[model samples]
Target: MSNYSIPYHDIDILIPSQKFEVNFSYTSSQMPNFIDSMIMRLLRISPLSVKNIAKFLGMNQRESRIVLDQLITNNEVELQQDGLFHLTNKSMKYFTTVDSIPKVASILEHTHSLIYELTNFNYIAQKPDNNMYGIKLIATSTHAANSENIVRDRFQKQFYQLIEEDIITLKKIEGRPSIYKMGTVKKVKECTVRKSLDLHVDAQAEPQAIKVLDSIMSDELKDKTYQALGQSKKGNNIRDILNNLDGFEQLKLNQYFKDGRFLAPNALFDSINPIESKSSDGNHLFIGPCYSQSNSKIILNKIKESIAKNHQVSSIYWLAPDDVFWGKSLRFNTFINALGQIKTKQNTDLQLKCFLPMHDEQDRTSVNNYRKIIAKDQQKYFYGIKDGILDGNFELIVVKNEFAVIVLHVLDSEAEYLTSFPFGSISYDKQLVNGLVSLFEAWERPKDDGGISFGQMFKKHSQS
Candidate 1:
């Protein structure tokens, strides 16, 4: 049908039945057309007439004859005296080459159940004296018992047969898990594949800020005290009082009568309870007792509101006495979610600063764990201060540089509290704002030249 041809003897050794080996030197770019590929693959097992090929391909006889004629002209197929078409030795060599097996295996792996059954048939077809040259796999109309087991058994048998025939290879490479290889698979010093773990949060998952906030607020009030103190002129004096108020008497005096001003527990709660209308203007700060998940959510919502109004939320700073309460009460996950929502829109403009006394090894470990769970991009916004700078039952959150919310814990000599709710206050006075802001800024500064930076701390702890 065409002029192109190759001497028959040159590729005689490529015939499958001859059991001779030949190197395939063709690149993937030179692969034949889909129809030719299918035709060659079909003829790999046995010769097929043009009509038979047409039937197999669901094509008309004339279309198949045209393709067969082109294949014959290219020396990819041969005409037999039996009036059948089969792959020439050259075509057989190409199909049987070890380089082709991985590609074939990949295709087989992607196929559904049909390939499982086909592999099983390939196993039986390869047995000595087996006359079966083709397999027809049909899906049963109804489910049958032991169907899965039957397929699995067949798949395993076929897998072993392929391994024995050198069509597939398995190797245990150093530093890598076991895997399958094509061609002469052998152990190597280095693994070709790299393994990693991906930890992801679903974007569609709703944040639980409201729920977490409610839970924290609903908890039994451990200690309550109300304060309405005027800003002290001497910043160092106030810092001294705060740092020295761990004793029962000092704790009580500071909690109940700060600067000779006091408010009832009910009044404190009413003032501090987040109101949407009150959040509209000015810089407000909320600082209180160790925050529960609920408290974190409430604070997060307030911060969200400030951001919504296009106000600059300067800082979220906390001072905890020890890591036990800090670790137990800090709702890192809930906070991350709420902050993530804001950051997704506004970015890392807000600052998050926390100062806790890492009194022991356990405290260091707990903080380290917290560092590991925080996202890398967010670590820049979050600063952790373990150096002892500020202490006592003090919680403070400042919003928009205008107001401050303070919570003081009331504790008696017996270590029991008079009320369940903690004492809280809201201050808009310029002096009080200045004093609190000054104190917060002073504490945020590094203790000495060699003090660890937040970035260095996160990196060192995250790796550990």
Candidate 2:
């Protein structure tokens, strides 16, 4: 078993920081991670001052003083009082001595923050014929080992598994005693998802009922939203979705777009273009609007060019929310509607018609541009899906905002896909995840009353 220690990365989410591609001679790999960092940071700046220590340790004067007092009591350091703690002459000499335990301990503790990649060497040794040193991968007895050497061998086997999984990577090497490096600290992508799973009564008996009850309560948030842009439920009314946006404060964004035709609050998004395609028969598809629909069109185009389903979209169908003031209508505020009409009427062979699922309430501003759409005298069918729900083409999005939440689960099984932001901005580690999940539960309802389940449809489609 090797006596040397290995450092592990802190799995904390962070606002991106400037990362230095550092290649340093790591002193050692020991525990007391924060202190180890403290020493390294001290050496980098001046030879350690209380001010510097506070900055490095992220402590204020009062807390810094407390720790400084402890170091002084241990005789590990001397306090300048007016300024920082200085290493005592004896302590300095002791540490500076080449092979002191403190020196080795400090080195071992400082090696955890680097990101490294393998550059070839399997293992290293002092001389060509010396014993092979470094990590080795293999299963060892999970049975508790009585000896230190035996225990280390088991851990070595486990370490290799982690390495192979890319949880860590080898960083660098040097002479004398060989050292292995791990983890080049960088922004690891994470997603904040609001998952809604149908309650399993056997497992989630208590909480599921609590969730349903919560939904029945008139939520200030939901009520405010309903007041702004909610539509009356009819069996066949389909609303055209517009945008899902991200916001810093979800409540604020929701309130700002209370009218229901703006981006979802706290959604981080990017533009995506979907390809267009046709089925075996010349059926036209009404791809939903905004960037998601755009990506769908692009993807459909590729499908047309590929053997998977050489199809092309002959026309595009879109939605215009009640808040949308343009497109279709020429008489209501002619200028805005004119611009909207121009946008929808782009291709000669393709048509860009408006589709709004919900009926307009008695307000001129609400239906200003919708008059021209009039569903073009076509019968409106209640959508197979609802707001914040994707019927199909869930994975067709191309470009999305920088912020996105990866929902692992949703009510029933409409998707195993990514939803774009502004759905109450979520993050991987925020304490609010539980609250957000509860919110989704309150708002969730069956998309179809007697219609087939999305899961059943998905399975049927897959089998076909």
Worst 10 residues of 1 by lDDT: 7-16
lDDT, candidate 2, residue 174?
26
Compared with the true structure, what per-residue lDDT tens digits does model 2 show for residues 89-126?
53453344333333333333122221211111111111
Best by lDDT: 1
Off by over 4 Å in 1: 1-298, 329-332, 343-348, 359-382, 409-422, 444-456
Evaluate residue 269 in candidate 1 and report its C-alpha lDDT on the 0 to 100 scale.
35
Q: Give the winner by TM-score.
A: 1
What's every prediction's RMSD, in angstroms? 23.3, 26.3
**Whole-model lDDT per candidate:** 0.41, 0.28
Provide the lowest-lDDT 10-residue window in model 2: 7-16
User: Residues 41-129, candidate 1, lDDT per residue (tens digit)?
Assistant: 77876689998999999999999999999989978899999898977766776654533521111111111122121111221222121
Please provide TM-scores, in order, for all candidate models, with all chains considered together. 0.35, 0.19
- Local distance difference test, candidate 2: 0.28
